[model samples]
Target: MITYNPKDWFTFIFRFHKADTLRQLAPLIIGISVYCWIVAFLELNVFRLSENSHVKNITAMHTLLSFVISMLLVFRTNTAYDRWWEGRKLWGSLVNNSRNLAIKLNAILGHEEAAHRSFFKKIIPMYASVLSHHLHAETTRLALDEHEHPELKNLDTNRHMPNQVASMMFQRVNRLYEEGKIKGDQLIVLNSELQSFTDIMGACERIKNTPIPFSYSVFLKKFIFFYVMTLPFSFVISLGYIAIPVVAFIFYVLASLELIAEEIEDPFGGDENDLPMIKMASNIKKHVAEILN
Candidate 1:
């Protein structure tokens, strides 16, 4: 994310760093430029290859190829964006469902019962916060510290972390029913709320595990690089020195779009562009505390 906006033409041309500035492309760019210069020199002084009828025909074919490559890049970018957007939407649903579960828990637990109400209200949000942290592989330090109840401190278990946290909440709800702290109907309502939370967890896990096919990614990357390398030759005869910068700009734009799509394709990663899992977990903590108070 380069954030600065260039207002003037000078800044616009010079300020934007080429996106394919990756170290892997350095040797490729240098080699291609040298190759192109040699080709141009031969055409101009040595062999006069550009004047050959066959060379003219090959250049025309490359022009059509460039158009096809451009279309492929566009389609690849769109596909990546779809995956990124879908992951974001899933997280958005997780937030809403978590909040709904908390509100329902508070209502069913009976806010008038001081101890049971306070415990259930506080624990419901703790479940969300803990689950969020668990999803991101964070330790539940803050979540554990927030609850005053002794039973919550012992809620820790050895199961899959997020599932373990959810189970803790389920156990607490079961205890409330067994101890007569909540009625049978109230237990049923709380169970439904807990089930919704489980559904959210499952959805997030599915998105995190599934990804775009490896073959498609490999094919697209190969095509983009090949297209970029071949681009300058198509323009060298007509555009001469101008071809270098023009080809670079076009390659940079295509590479940048591809890189961005890669970054967002897995929204759960620790990348800056990834969904802020830590922040969401913290927010769940804050919201739960407010409801308890």
Candidate 2:
């Protein structure tokens, strides 16, 4: 959601304010640093256990752990990015379908038909907004004013506002068909759009409901934790006081990867890297109105 000129890469990097990773991972990083420091201090100064530390051989595990952890992190990031990309694609499809539906409706009924134009202009975008809010698990969010969309009162009460809004679209199309405003091939086209609306919503719902498996996530976290935790043991003996920062950096990399994966795995939510649902819906509303204009 952080928008800026791509040409100004330096300013973009320096000034981007969405500190999502730092906000979440800073505490864990600090805790890991503190833990590493404590272990180093005790081993180097107080106990001197690191001087004769037999566990220096544990550094050998780092080769295999490093490879496994890298592969795991790669898998985790890819899985999350796949979900995020799919969400973006779905929203893109919704945008196209809404525009197509709007254009087809306007063309068929004549743009001078104020009631018909208004219905498509308002309702299609409203469906997007409602679906966006619904996917974020937010209730009581209305994109259209009651004066414009009196159905929100009924929609508010429905368990699934997006589907209800889509149903409303269907009813409107059916009305157009019965009144002969859009029948035959035109009806088929409109019905296809309606079906696309439903199908897109269903696809978004599937992504929202399903997630990266919990056990897989837990195992990765545990794997990274135990592996990085053993870093100080191997390191304090060799690096002396420098092991704290080294372990901390290692912890930062490993922990940040997991945190990032968690954040993006559910890309429907309002994260920095999430599909900008509200903005997309709002743009849909803007474009719909512009088309009618």
Candidate 3:
């Protein structure tokens, strides 16, 4: 994600970041400007309608519908942001759970049980990296170092990688319990963090698989398009040629909201605004190593 100081208002206002709505909407803005000029010219110069023409009544319709459109856009943007925030929270949970599991394992295992310590250390972070890749639908084998764990060897890439990694961690933990390394209560403590790995994975999958309703998204886009198209008719009588900029600016604002909603709705992707999955995964590795090693 692109990091910036929220307090620096002047920099954000003047500097156009790569994912800025202005860059994406520039072509559409120019097209709307030209369309507005044509509509204004035809109405004022050619048709020469009188001041009391019925077409001017479109302004009242626009004024009334403006509230409705604003409400819809607010809902759309809020829904998308909720998904983005939820994804961040899930990752935050994974980071904490991974550290918690490592700390418990470190305390439970004897110093001579370095093999068990190493296994939990690597597997805990590996689960996070595998989950990050799995959510993106990329090959998760790339996230693993094959030599790290024999249990992780020959992991079926065709199967769900996160589940495979989680299974390995569970099996090792169970083996520790069966071998009398971890007491019953210690196993119970570790179980919560281990189970949470699957819960986090499932929640992330829900966000990645599901999306904003198709019909609703399409309706919003259509509403914005038709609403802006009818705006020139409403403004030409009063705003005249100046309606060119006014109409274009209105389209820019409305369309930009939709564009932002689209980008943030799927927070797992490589978008600059997406949750920082890779960075969080690396932090999980670092934090797990510190606790376990």
Per-prediction TM-score: 0.78, 0.91, 0.97
Q: Model 3, 1-293: lDDT tens per residue? A: 89989999998888988899999899989998999999999999999976789999998899999999999999999999999999999999999988888887888888899888887778889899989898888887554456766566768999998998888888998998899887898888888888999999999999999999999999999999999999999799888999999999999999999999999999999888998898999999999999887
Expressed as tens digits, the lDDT of each residue in 1-293 for candidate 1 is 23455566787665535442454356655665666676567555676545443554556666777788778768777877776677667656666766766676666656566676566556666665666566566566644444467766555545566676678678878987898877898888778867877787787777667776889788878887777767655566666656666766666666766777787776767666667766765576577656655
Clashing pairs in 2: none
Cα lDDT over the full model 1 = 0.66
> Of models 1 and 2, which has the larger TM-score?
2
Cα displacement (angstroms), candidate 1, residue 73, comes to 3.0
Better of 1 and 3 by TM-score: 3
Which has the greatest lDDT? 3
Q: What C-alpha lDDT values do all the predictions have?
A: 0.66, 0.83, 0.90
Q: Candidate 3, which segments miss by more than 4 Å at Cα?
A: 143-145
**Native-vs-model 3 lDDT?**
0.90
Cα-based RMSD of candidate 1 = 4.2
